[model samples]
Every structure is written in structure tokens, then in C-alpha cells.
Target: MAQQRDPRGSRALKELGDRGLYWFDNTLARGAAALVGWLALLCLAVVVPVSTVLVWTDPAVPASAPARLAAVWRLTGETLRLGGKTGPPLRMTMSVLLALVALLYVSLLVGLITTAITDRLTELRRGRSTVLERGHVVVLGWSEQIHTVVAELVAANADRRAVVVVLADRDKTAMEEALATRVGPLGRTRLICRSGPTTDPALLSLTNPATAGAVLVLPHDEPGADAEVVRTLLALRTLLAHREGGREARPCVVAAIRDDRFRLAATLAAGPDGVVLESDTVSARMVVQAAGRPGLSHVHRELLDFAGDEFHVVAEPALAGRTFGEVLLAYATSSVVGLVRGGTPLLAPPPDTAVRADDRILVISRDDDAVRLEDCADAVEVAAMAAGRVVPERAERVLMLGWNRRAPLMIGHLRRSTLPGSAVDVVAAGAVGIDRSDLADGPRSGLLVTVHEGDATRPEALHRLDVGSYDSVIVLGRDPAPGDPAGEPDNDTLVTLLLLRQWEESAGRALPVVAELADDRNRVLAPTGPHADVIAHGKTIGLIMTQICRNRHLTPVFDELLRADGNAVRLRPAADYVRLDQETSFATVVAAARRRGQCAIGYRDHAAVHRGLGHGLRVNPPKTERRTWSALDEVVVIGA
Candidate 1:
């Protein structure tokens, strides 16, 4: 029948079908498409062969081959549908059993698919997604300074839409929680947090450094933080090199190096346009400067904070060709402190120095938009007060309490600033030692140094030192004991401050005391007396880092101001610059300082200092305004 039709070809066709099935089963077990593949295999393996066997064994089944195939198809479909009214009773019973098995297999497949989806979601939350934002500020690494930096950036861009993305080798949820607690609300700034190793190039890309407006590298407080910062810079450089347009199209980078030794290396890694700050040297110098002037810490804080008056650079064509002295009185609501020309900052330049057309005036104001010049029609007349005698430099006795890593640097700075015959006495519970050999051959070789071991917080130690005899007292914040929290250092500092205040009260004489603090929050706990000058270490460093990030030109200006051999910030007697108890314009004071080869920026009122208020430290005062001075007042000047 039909020429005994091709038995060999039919057998070959059957064998090909069997081989295809075997291949499909293996592929399903290996590939991601296994779920659908396994489901198909399960239906075919359980229903197709079983349906064929049942129809062939049944005597009532169709006799022809096509009829048998149709019966098999109907049975397989009925099994998947659970049961059918038109099917034979026996066939329907069998369909129910096969349906239960299929249902069990489908449940297993659903469970596996759900687990796969959950794993992907978890990975995404771990900060593996690529960022698509442009012009955002990217902060690399995490440290205590992050809160201050973010807060400052938020305040700086409060009126505009901005984004700040933080990438660190910390838990994403933990970082977000810390930020939420420290920074309560960000008005117009959007904050994003990602968790990854900051030194890894691939991980660094998660913050999209190529498109960022600026990248800030924060140094950890632990040992070897400088190395970590340097590594991060290198990683950023690598990413920049691979960017679409290369280095020129890369974002600006700013980094802080705790150790001065690594500054050059960090700078190289950051490229010529990037900024690398020497944080240790900056903090030491600031502490020394604050120690010399009792109320200087407050002045630094005001200049560094965004909530108060901050430094801003603005171009003013109308001010071009005018003298620095004339431009000082140009702004009604702002104070011109210096001039920025060719990207270099010149603070308190000579009064005769002319402002160029391309120069930008560095002004202290509430905001950049608020820097406006007004007509000087209502300016007060400049009256030359009778000149007073210059005060002679004299040697004095000083007392230092407590000790830390910064003690030696502070001592060296003290030596450089004080007269040769001056003496410094250091007392602390721990071993207080410094290399006095270097001082032996310097100009300050004559300065005396004494070290004593005692608990500074005790009443007996205060009495033994005869605190009132010293011209000034410096209390350095103590390091916390092992296992103690960070705030403990500040707590000890506060206690020492209270004891000093008591000592001054009992001695019935105001003692000039400059107290160093580890945390800014403890500043409020300090006694509200003129004798207590509180300087927060963390706040000072935070402000410096923020300033460098905002403008790199300030680095050299700060270095010069804080260096021992360069121009320094000094509070000399007001009488040395101008006559006392007579109304005189600041312009006359400027002239007097110029005569001495010094630059006068402001003056401090001794009366205000005695009242524990900072209203006395008047910086960038209007040049045409007339004010009376006292013998106790000090003129703020930048001098040799």
C-alpha cells in the first residue's frame, strides 16, 4: 500500500525528532530561558507519551493512524484543561491525575522566578545602577567632615536646583541615616548616596565623575588617610583619562591631604587644575593664630560659615582704575577685603594699589547677588586724629594646659610670634615633650620652655601654676581615652574651662584664656565671660576645606597669613595706629598702618571682648566712617 512507503526515511525522521528533544532538554538546563523550556518539556514528557499509550491500548480508540493522532491530541489538551464533558469517562479520569502533576511543576517554576527577581532588586539597592545625572557635585569617600561640606554646599546653592552624590566604602543605608540626622532638611538640593570602594575605578564611575560639576575628596580621620586620599585621586585620574573627550572634558577635582608630605604627590594626581590642601598645617596655624588673639576663633568661624557673611569674588567695571582705599567704601552692604587678578588673591593690598578693569573684588557679603556698589555722597568726612606713641614690644609669661599631637606645632608657632624673652610653661597629665634643640639656634632661642606633669582639670594644678601671673593661658583639648566616644574630649575641655573661670573669679582678675575644643557643639557650653576664648578644631578644618573647594586661590593667602616668616594677622594696640578717645575715620588708620608698612583691615574693641561678645572684631569697616577708640582697643593688621 503506497509502495511500502519509504520505511528507512520514516525511521530516519523519527530518529531526528528524538535527537532534537535531547538537545532541547540540555539547553534548557544550562540557559536563563530554562523556566519556559522546562515547562514545555514537562508538558510534552508527561502528557504526549502518556496520551499516545492510553489511546493505543484502548479498544474503542480510532483504527486509522490520522484518527489515532487526533485522539491523542484531544487527550493531551484535555489533560492541560483538567477535564472535559465530551471526553470518555476513563480519559477524563486520567486527565485529572496528569493536571495535578502539571500544577505542582508550575508552582516550582514560579518560586524560582520570584527568587531571581528578588536577587536582582537587592543588587540594585547596593548601588550598582549607573547614574545619569549631569552637573552634580560628587563627594568621594566618607568622613566626619561630610556633614559640614554637604550643609555648606546646600546653603551655597539653596536658591537653585542642585544635586550632591556621595560615594564611600560604607553601608548606603547607614550613610543616608547619618546624613538625615546631621543634615535635617535640604531645601532645593537633592542628595544621593552610593556604597562602594572609593579607590576602585569601576566603583568610582557609579557617581558619574565625568559629568560632575566638582568632585571633593574627603580624608578619613584614621591613620594613613593621606594615602587613601592619594589613591582616590589616582583612580579619578584614570577615569578622567578614559572619558569621552579626555582630561579637558573631565570635572574639577578638590582633595584634602592630612599630611603635608603627601601634598605634592596628591597635586600631581589631581592634575594642574585640581586643588590639594594640607590640612594638618592649616589646622595648626589656625590654632596658633587663635591662641594669640582671644576672639580670633569667632572671626574665622564667621568668615567660613555660609549662614553669616562669607567671602565672594565679583567683577566691577565701575571700580576699575580706583584705588583699593576708594573701593573699600564703594559697597554699602558689602566689605571689599581684597582683589583677585589673574586668578591670584591679594588680601589687604596697599591702599594706593589700583583696581584693574579685569580684576575681581573679594567682598564679604551675605550672597554674591547682594554685592553692589553705592554712591559715597553720604560718606563721613575723614579727620586726622592726633598721632599717638607706638607701643614697645615686651616679653611675657604664658601657660599651656593639656596636650595632643598639635602641641609641638603650637609651641613652635608661639615661639615665632612672641618676643625672645617670653616664656611658655606646659602642664598636662600625659608626657609633654618637644624638640627645643631647634629653638636653640633660631632668633627665638632666648624664649624659655618649661614642662610639668599634672592633671590640668584639678584645682591644685591651677593653684600650683599661679594662673593669674601668666599673661595668657592656652588650654588644648585632650585626647579621649581608649573606648571613649569622640565627645569625651570636648567634655574634658569644658570641665577645664569651668575650672579656669573659677580660678579667674577667685583671683579677682580677668585672665586671658584661649581654650581649644574638638567639637563645635561644645562651644555653647563654654563660660560666657570675656576671659574664655573657645576654638573648635573640627569646625576650623571643615571651614578651611570648604573654602578651598569653593576657591583654590585662597590656599596661598591662608598660608601667607598663617606662616611664621610671611605677613601675619596681628592685634596690636590701637594707640600704636591712631589716637585714643578721639573720633577718626578708618582711612586715617589705614594711612597710619601704611606708614609702618602694615595693612589695617579692622579693629577690636577691648570693651566688647570683656563682655564675651564678638561685636568688637570689626573687619572690613567702612573707610569713611568715623569712630572713637580706647587705649585698650587693638587694631587688626597684616604685618611682618
Candidate 2:
């Protein structure tokens, strides 16, 4: 060099510069913060040094070093539009260049800040923020059942302010829009949607499960839904364990599993206080029950749905020590259907059985608050007991249309409900075959199931079956289309129903037809038929899941009711409980049913059944209400 340079000083400076560059690169690679920070640093470093140099070299500049420094600061502020006046105005060429440099720096700063803000907003919309709520209902996962569950919850909490927070792997805006389209007005209930995978512990915590009132885990509509449900339950458990209050603070968790084999594992995963429902078995049992007894699905819909009368467990001390039959008349507005003692529901218990002080009466009413016991002894008019006759079970011919995975289970149920020599003919478009070995037990139980290959939707195929020849015809919902699984199979079901109705009209006879539907909305869309009973599968399961989430104890009660064995809800002949063609009070009807070891909850008028008027199926009628019964009217009862 010109003058011997200090090699050590030069090397030291080089090392320092290398370290600084390394740090800057690492920081820049970190994320949005680093990018913004680096941009800010570069702007300051360039603008300050350049402004100082310009101030010192400019023709209209201060002479003193202190004045020059002050002028540089002023110039920097003015360039950044931060406010300040520097020396005299520069020449035209210099002013233009300075203004362009200032504009460049300002644009860079504005762009960085805007980008940071936009990114933050996007993250928020992605539902990464934690929820700060207590006593809210947390729904984990998204599916068709969500709409029904949310609507039911909204309806249940109509009189009170409630919050339902939805956590699922979906766009927050998309979920909100879908719900808005499907669920209409929510009344006083506030619905909050969050976007994230429900199985993530971090996301689960965002739902505030530890402080939630209840948690409903809906299985996604995909393969291995039960596996996902189990995983979600595990995540919830982990979140609950880490909560500040510990296990005691955990909310009630309820989930629906599709496979019965996985039910035990899911139940254990849900803890002692949780509930896991086997949805497939429940739906299969429902199909069988509905096929055996027309209008039974409607009865279940009423009891399970929040829009109508539902089951409530209320402790009525006023009825303590009184016989169940006597207590039945104690509620003018509510109907006492069962007794729960020691956490066991005794539906249709003995008439003379005493109601203990601690017994909780299972009452059916429009709402829990509406369930009231009054002194209605004078209001109840007990009619004179008339001759009652039990309808004997007989072998009958049944027709089944379409097929799905539920067919085998439904056939087993049919065998249990029907008599020996009962025949069931299954007709479908495809040549789907059922293993005789799988249905061997059905024939031994007196029900024979045969599968026929034919398109049931076609008139020729339906005509060949002689629809009027069967006692009851079941049109099971077909497998969903590959392209559109959410689409309802009701089109085929509706066509089959119309054909059956036409056949009945031509033959001058009515055939009881129980049609399985994929969507509840389709029930209204399909033409109403006198003999048709539509069972909306998704809606039914959703209703059951919602009911269990509200009260877990009902799980066992519903299980016992839907099982093939033990006592079940049946629509027996009205003559079996009371004399037909004679005006009788429901009080006498209740007593008559009790005499026959059954409980009469309601009755379906024959006219209603023949005309497909569901309103005629009255449940929990007033004890004082009197009506003349027809021979064809069926008494809705809980019996073995």
C-alpha cells in the first residue's frame, strides 16, 4: 500500500464484516419479521449516509460540522416525509434526484408494512388464534351431520343465549357460508367457525374444550372416519389433561363411531364420563324397526328432535311413593314414560311399581322447562275398562328394494321381529349377491331373505313383484353416486314409492312402504304417499348424537329401546289396549296396557296411518282426553 497498512486491523475488520453479513442473512431468512426488519435496516443505513454526504457536498450547505450534521438530519426527515426543513433548496437537477431517492425508500417501507399486515390478517382468517370462551358447545370436525347438529342445538337453546364454536379442517369463511345456507337464522345462538385440523392438540385447545359445556365429535364422511374420531378424542384428552384445572375440568365428550367393532375402543378413549355411539348399528336397527312397524321412524324423529317433544329426566318429588300408573296422570302437560333409579332407566315399568324419592321420571314435553307435575287427579277421567285383545304374530311376506351395507343387519333384525315362514324379496338394479351363510341365522329364526336382480325403479320390474302382495315394502337408500356422494338417493326411492302407490290404487289395497332417505330435506321434496314412511338417515343419526351430547344417560335407554331383544317401542293394535268403536280416556288405555304388561305412550289413528297424516300419530296425550278408537288404530306402546 501507499503507507504500510496494519494487516491485523484490516483482517479484524474483514472478520467483523463477515460475521455481520452472516447474521443479516440468517435474520432475513427467519420469516416476515426478519424481512421487515432487514428492509428497515437497509433503508436507514442508505438514507442516513447518503443524506449526510449530500448535505456536506451540496452548494447550498452549512459550513460548520455541527451545522452540516443538523442539515443531514433535516434532509433525512424531509426525504422520508417525517417533517423538517433542510438548508436552502437545491438546484433543479439535485432536487429531482433527491426526490426520486426519497420516493424509492418510501415505497419500499410502505410495501413491507402492507405485506406484514396482509399476512397477519390471513393467519387470523385461517383460525390460528386461540378462542377465549367458556361454557360454549364445541363441535369438532365437519360433515353433513354438522348442519343438523348445529340446527338442533340452536333450537334447543332458543330461549337462552348460547355459543357453538365449530373447529374443522375447512376455510373459516367457507364454513360460515355453508352454515348460513343450510341453517338459516340461529336466533339467540351465536355460531363461531374456526379453520384447522380438529385432531391437532393446538387446534383442540383453540376450541377451549376444557371450559366447554359439551363437546360433540362428528365423524368425517370418508374412509376410516372412526379412526379419525378416535384420534380426535385422544387429542382432546391430551388437551384436557394439560388444562389448569386438570381432569375434573374436562367437558363432557360425545362422539359417534361408524363401526361397532371400534365402539369399545372409542368408549374407553372417551373416558368414564364420555359417550360413544355405534351409528351403523343404530341406523341398521332403526331400518329394521321401521320396516317392521310403519310410522315408528316418525315417532323416533319426534322424540329425538328439538323442534318437537323430547325426552327429559326430571325428579318429581310430588309423585314419590306413588305407583307409576297413578303418577302418569299427575302431569297434565308432560307424559311420564319411564323411571330412572340408580342411573338405570326403567321404561314402561310395572303400573303398581312405587316411584322412589330419588327416582327421576323420564318425561316427554316440548321443553325441559315445560315439564311440570300438577294435581290433576280431578282432571283425569278414568273410563270403564273394556275387553282387550292381543294381536297374534303371524308369518307375512315382505318386499325390499335397493341394497347397501346395512342390508344384512336389517335382515337379521327383520328375522327377530317377524314370525316363521316370513318371506323377504330384495330387488335391486345390480346383480348384488348376499352370502347365504351370512343370512343363515335369519332363516332359522323364520325369516327368509332372497335377493333378485332387477331395477326396482322401473315399472316392469316393480310390477313383477306384485307390490300389494307383501305386508310391508322397504325401499332402502342405494349407495351414493361416485361423482356426488352427498346427493340424495331419494330420486330412485321416490320413483319406487310412486310406483308402489300406483299399484296400491289399482289393486284397491294399501301397502305399508317404509322408504330410507339420504337427506331430510328430500323428505319434503318427495311426493307424499298414504303408505310411505321416510326415514332420513343422516338427520336421524344427527338427532341421536345431539340428544346424547345433551344427556349421556339416554344412550343406554335408547340402546335398550333399539335392540332386537328386550322391551321395544311397538305400534300394536289399539284393540290390544282398549275396546274399539268405544270412547275411552287415555287413563283407561294406560291401565289396559299395564294389565297386559305393556306401557301405552300414545296411539296412531287408523285414518292417519292410511292417509299418511303423521300429525295423527299423537304421543303423550292428556290422561283426560277421550276419543273413540278404531279397530285399525294402533296403540303406541313400550313392550317386550
Candidate 3:
């Protein structure tokens, strides 16, 4: 039961509460009372001594003063009756009281001032304190992509101080709040946010581009990100070129390339090491490559992502002044993946080659490249080269069986590999638009873009292109409209391949049929067997997205990976099978590619028992390379 309270106590509490005093609550009231008492005492220290001095010093300090003094003396005498003090304690007592008041006043003043100064100073320190270190990476721009970029930078900079400074025109506080809410928390990395235009160098200075280890100029949200990256690069270049602003000498700069033409421009402006990420071009290439080589996108992902091991530009002192193939064997135990010698990449050299000084030796290894190599079994690569069969280069007429979304990209990649004046006939069922206005138009001239209208799936229409005249036919997936819920581009490609197989059979020889399959389930429809290569679009998209999530920095890695030449990724026939050794080292393959100016990071062997498992192939081999390899090994290398 609730007890009745006392009225006097409730009234006292109400009075205290009305004055913002809650003495009814014991702990709170004690604290408040103590504060007020101290303040009142401090006031007394000022007021009492000054009042006494005014009375004591005045000439007219008067008869009233004498009367007040007499009254005090009378009171003192009454106290003397109670034995308080002798002779009214006049001279000694007054002197002690005045001295005590002065001491108390000085003490209170000093304490209050010290507390105020210290509190303010500490607040200032806590508010604006942050540190950015050397070799730290900076990302400029905010998108759904920035989240992926941030997570990757944290992993990459794990061994060191990996700072990812974000500079966007958005609210700095909001960005930081969003990051904290999304990623939960990150370590080592200090996420600094700066507000301003990304194209502005002064805002970029917050990233300390000059002192920064590297800068990644991300594409903005608008269609103009490519242009912004270019402009940002120009700003970065201006920063790098200038001697002012303590810009830390401009570490390395990387950017995303939206257009092919701009990629070249960015490369020139940013410097030799600068990387240009061509998003759409690469995404399109992955789809095309996956169309031809199933699960290759996964191989690209593991190599490019920061979570796993990959290629790096390491210095090969022994390879300096040595032949390319000779250098490969010299470091046989260690793979001399490629030569970044004087910025001239002589990757995967042929046997009996030479290496020079000032070459940044590009090699592939497991982990983030912290491992040290004592020796490389590169010498055996030359001997193996002597035994392995050379991939015969055949010059033949190639006809395009069908054309669709990846048609232009296939034509572009083909331009790099195709002979001068090679005929390419586009067999499309609908009106094949070959306008120069489209961004898909190939930069090279003289490549024919003839569009023949007919049902490509029908055997008669397939014959119209004279499929036998061409040695290779690449069938592209059709474009699907947004409203069409049941469109099947890969199904159409498979049908075209089915029709083309008849022509090849009629000619009494097998022509390479490279077709794009949107669904991996339709992969088995190609009757040309191994003679025809099927590319799956879904797998490539998944791998690209997965790899980006793993390490968004890999955009450049894929960019270089899809390029036809100049330090690019390539698939080559392996020297030997893996039947003899259960332990096949990546260094053995790396050793092989080095001999041929190639970087062998991974492989795909048809003879492997579990060939289709884990995206077919992802080989990050053991550190040592003493084991023998079997004939089933397929060497995967990268280099010009």
C-alpha cells in the first residue's frame, strides 16, 4: 500500500523543485547544495573583506563605526562570560579573520579559472584530432561502390596503416555516419571525410594526394564520372606537377575508364603507372570471355581481388642484363612472371631471351606478395619449351554467325587479333544497326560491318553467309528489351550455333564455333563439342560482381586482364600433365611463362578429375617448386 506523505516535507520539496532544486532526491540535492554553498562562500570571500576594508579605511569611518565596534565588544564580553576569548580579542582576532578571508578568495579564483581552461582545451583536442599516414590510399567519390572500395582498402592495408580518405561533395558527417552504420566498424584504417567537389584539388589535398601512397579517382554517379575522373586526374596531375601544398610527391594514381578513348588520355595524363578502369568495356569483355571460356571469370576474380594472392611488379636483379628465357630458368623455382623493365613490359618471353636492369619484374605468388624466394626453377622452362608442342598459328577467314549486345565488343577484341582486311559478316535476323554514332563502334577502320537480314536459326539463312568460307564464327546473344519478361538471348545464340554446325559438317571440316550463352544450363547445346567454345553471360557477371565486392581496386586488374596485348592475361597449353605429381607448383608454371614473357598464375586442365569444381581452376601453388608436373597441366600466363 502507498503511504501518505508529510505535508511539510512535500511543501519543502515543491518549493525546492520550483526553484530547479531537487533536494528531495538526496544524491542530486547534495551535489547541488554543495555547489551552491561553495559559490556562496566564494561570494563571501569577495564581499566580506571589501566591506570590512571600506569601513576600516574611511576618514568618516565614524561614530557609527565606534558604536558598532562597541556593540561587538559588548557581544564579545557576553561571550567572555562564556569564556570565548580574553579582553574581547580585538587586535589579534580581527587580523586573523581578515587574512583568512583573503586566502580563501585567492584559492577559489585560481581553482575556478584552472578548471575552465583545462576543460576547454580538452574539448578542442577531442574534437579535431586525426592522423593520416604515408602510403595510405584515398578514394574520391560516393556511390554504392564506395562501400566495396572501403572494405577492400581495409583488407589491403592490414599490414600497414591503410587509411581510406573519402572526398565527396556530400555531407562529411553523413558519409561517416553511413559508413559506421553499414560496415559496423573497421580497424587500422581511419576514414577521413572531406567536403567539396571531387574535381577540386584543394579538397583532394585533404586526401593529401601528393603525400598519399596512391589515389583512386572513382567515377561519379552521373554519366559524366568518366569526364570527372579525367578532370580529377587533371587536378591530381596539377597537384603532382606543382611544388606547392605539400602534396607528398604524388604517389600512384588509378582511375576508372568509362570510354576507351579517354582511357588512353588518362593514362598519358596520370603517368606510366597510372591505371584506367574501363567499366563497361571490361564488363562486356568478361561476358564475351566467359562465353568462350566457361568459369574464366572466377579465375579473373581470384587473381584480381585483394583477399587472395596476385601479380605484382617486383624487381628482378638477377634477370637484369639477361635473356628473357634465360631469366625465366635462372629463377626457375620462382616465376619471373613479366618484365616491367624501364616501363617496357616484355612479359612471358620466348626461350633464349634477355632481361635488363631497371625492370620491375612482374611475378605471381600466393598471399599478398610477402613471401621471399631463394631460387627459381626457370632453367627447366627452356628445356620444357623444347619438348612442348607449339600452338600453330593459323590464318583463316572468320565469319560472324550472329550479332547482338556483345557484337561490337567481339568485333573490337577481334580487331586486335584479326588480320588486316579480314572479312567479318554480321548475320542478324533484324535490321542490324551499324551506325558510327553508337559508342560500340570499333575505333579501327576497314573492318566490314555488313548486316544480312534473315532467320539465322534456319539452315537456308545460315547457308546465305557461306559459313564454310569462314574458319571461325562468333555468335552473339540478342539484346532484351526492358518490357520483355521472357526474352532468351542465349537460346537464340544456341539455335544459330545448331544451324552453323550443319554447314561445318557439310563442308567436311569443323569450324570453330564461339557462341555466347546467357545461361550455363544451355552450355551443352553446342554439338561441335570441344571445337566450339560456349561463353556463359551469367557466370561472368557473378564473378565480376563478386570480385569487385572482394576488392574493388581490381577494376584495373580486369582492365589489363581483358586487353589483347601489353601485359595481358592469356590461356596457353601446359607443358606437361599433372598425373606424375600431386603437388604442382605455380612457380613451375610461372617459370615457364617467364621464359616466354608470360605470367602463369593459374591453370585449367581438362584431364583433372575434378575439372568443373570451384570454377574449374584457381591455382595458388605452394612456395617450393621441386615437384614434377604431368601432361594435363594447362599454363595460364599474363604478359605482352
lDDT of all the models against the reference? 0.77, 0.80, 0.58
lDDT over C-alpha atoms for residue 551 of model 3: 41
Model 1 spans > 4 angstroms off: 1-113, 244-249, 375-378, 384-388, 432-444, 479-484, 564-640
| Least accurate 10 contiguous residues by lDDT in model 2 | 84-93
TM-score of each: 0.78, 0.82, 0.55
The best candidate in terms of lDDT:
2
TM-score of 1: 0.78
Best-matching candidate per TM-score: 2
Per-residue CA lDDT of candidate 2, range 128-223, in tens?
777788899999998768999999999989899999999999999899999999999999999988889988898778888888989999988777
Per-residue lDDT of model 1, residues 596-617, tens digit only: 6566667788788667565477
Kindly give the stretch of ten consecutive residues in candidate 1 with the minimal lDDT sum: 377-386
Q: What ranges in model 2 sit over 4 Å off?
A: 1-105, 244-249, 375-384, 442-444, 481-485, 606-614
Task: Supply candidate 1's per-residue lDDT for 352.
Answer: 86
User: Sort by lDDT, best first: what order?
Assistant: 2, 1, 3
Predict model 1's lDDT versus the native.
0.77
What's the CA RMSD for each of the models? 13.3, 11.5, 13.7
